[model samples]
Target: MIQKGSTLPEADFSQLKNGEMTNPKTNDLFGGKRVLLFAVPGAFTPTCSHAHLPGYVALADKIKAKGIDSIVCLAVNDAFVMDAWGKAHNADAIEMIGDGSAEFTKAIGLDMDTSVFGGIRSLRYAMIVNDCRVEMLNIEDPGRFEVSDAETMLKAL
Candidate 1:
């Protein structure tokens, strides 16, 4: 897992724009910015849909008010699925990042093999990144939602 003060690993993440998929480099997305990044195991999953993502959405404004430049929700899914899930949840305040190939997740040492869920997926985690360097990291235990939840992150900030 990535640790505080470590630079964010380089990777490509995709976003859906006008029905087209566009890949954005990690530096371009996080450089010189205060970013709140959270990862889910999969898109549209029960816990993610019901709690994790929603908590961030609910507290997005308050979080940004604390000087966060962006809030990103990452999942090991394609751009289309991520975009759809964001829309379904009214996640207009958050940027839904798609790690379709799990490159970023693996690079950060947060990849987990949950083929039963849907192949290899990212572990549930959250981080505060400043200018591409990690300032705080919270990784949840398997099937748990404790340290990585929005409320905990907010308190950390």
Candidate 2:
């Protein structure tokens, strides 16, 4: 798990742009701004689709209002899956990001293999990072959920 007040690991990935995709790194995206980033195991899985992503989507506007420059949603899935999932969920408020290869998630020390999935993946987590530094982190407890929600993150901010 990532610790509070630590620097967030950098990630470079593509985002949907004009129906295509844009290549950008973590520094480029949140360079001098506040960022709220969340990660899920996959793009369209049950917990992610029904709960995690929606929570961030529903709070994107509010998160921005609280001075967040961008609300980024990341997954290990490819750009197509991430983009498609975002479109399907009406995730216009936040930026849909594709980690594709899980490089960023592992760098941040949030990688785990949920025995159920039988493969490496990013744990369900969320964090508020400023200038690439972590100001707050809300990593879920294994398979149990206690934090890592918009409401909790908003409160921290």
Instruction: Name the top lDDT candidate.
Output: 1
Expressed as tens digits, the lDDT of each residue in 1-157 for candidate 2 is: 4687887667778787778778788788777888998888888888888888888888888888999999989888777888899989999888888887778888888888766773778888888888888887888887755688778887777
Q: What is the TM-score of each candidate against the true structure?
A: 0.97, 0.91
| Candidate 1 Cα outliers beyond 4 Å, as residue runs | none
lDDT of each: 0.93, 0.83
Q: In model 2, which range of ten residues has the least summed lDDT?
A: 112-121
Which whole-number lDDT from 0 to 100 does residue 150 have in model 2? 78
The sequence of per-residue lDDT tens digits that candidate 1 reaches over residues 32-135 is: 99999999999899999999999999999999999999999999998999999999999999999999999999999999999775898999999999999999
Q: lDDT of model 2 at residue 69?
A: 91
Q: Which residue pairs come into collision in candidate 2?
A: none
Q: After superposition, how far is residue 103 of candidate 1 from its true place, in Å?
A: 0.4
